[model samples]
Target: MARMFRVLGFFTLVIALMSFAGDLTEMSLLFFVQTVVFFLLGYLNFTEKTYILLFWAYMVLSFLGFTYWTVFRMGLPF
Candidate 1:
C-alpha cells in the first residue's frame, strides 16, 4: 500500500509538471500539493486498512470536487 501511494505520488508529480508546462498554474499547484501529501503519507507506517480508507476518502473528495467544478464553475450551456 505504501508503495502504491509512492507510485501515485510520482504520477501526480508528472501531472503537476505537465500542467505547469501547459500554463495551468492553479491545477499544477493543486497537483503539486497532492504529490507532496501522498509522498508524506507514503512514508508513514500506517496499516493496510488505514491506507485503503485514506485512499477511498481521497477518491470521494476528488470526485465530488470535480463534479462541483464541472457543474458550477464550467458554466456549460445545458
Candidate 2:
C-alpha cells in the first residue's frame, strides 16, 4: 500500500504539473510530502515494531495535507 501511495502521489504530482490549473507548486509540494510519508509507511509496515505510532502519524499528516491542499486549495468547492 505504501508503494501504491507513492505511485499515486507521483501520478497526481504529474497531473498537477501538466494541468496547470491549480497551484502546481503547492500541489507538487504536498504530493512530495505524501510520497515521503508513503515511503516511511512502507518501511514501518515492514518492520517488527510493537507499535506503529509513526504509521498513524503518517496517516494523519498525509490525509490532512492532501485534503487541505486539494479541497481548499486546488480542487472542487474551494
Candidate 3:
C-alpha cells in the first residue's frame, strides 16, 4: 500500500513536470493540484520520513518553476 503511493507520487511528479510544456495557466493549475495530491499521498501512506521530505522538496521546486514561468516569463503580476 505504501509502496503503491510512492509509485503513484513519482508518476504524478513526472506528469506535473511534463505539464510545463503546456499553456502557462494550465500548467500552473495542473502542477499545483498534482503537488497537493502528491503531498497528501506521501503524508498518508509513506512510513519513511525520507519519502515525505522528498515529496516536499519536489513540491517546492515545482511551485518555484511555476512562479518563474508565470511571473517572469509570462509577465503576470502573480
Query: How do the residues 10-63 of candidate 3 rate in per-residue lDDT, one tens digit apiece?
Result: 776677667765656675567568666665765565567766676578669979
* Candidate 2 residue-wise lDDT, 27-77, digit = tens: 666666655655555555454342255556666977997789888879696
Name the candidate, 1 or 3, with the larger lDDT value: 1
Assess the local accuracy of residue 36 in candidate 1 as a C-alpha lDDT between 0 and 100. Answer: 98
lDDT of 1: 0.97
Q: Is candidate 1 or candidate 3 better by TM-score?
A: 1
Which candidate achieves the best TM-score against the true structure? 1
Model 2 lDDT on a 0 to 1 scale: 0.61
Measured by TM-score, how close is model 2 to the native structure? 0.39
Please rank every candidate by lDDT, starting with the best.
1, 3, 2
Q: Give the poorly placed runs of model 2, Cα more than 4 Å off.
A: 1-23, 46-78
Residue-wise C-alpha lDDT for candidate 1, range 1-78, written one tens digit per residue: 999999999999999999999999999999999999999999997999999999999999999999999989997896
Error of 2 at 12 (Å): 5.6
- Stretches of candidate 1 off by over 4 Å are none
- Maximum-lDDT candidate: 1
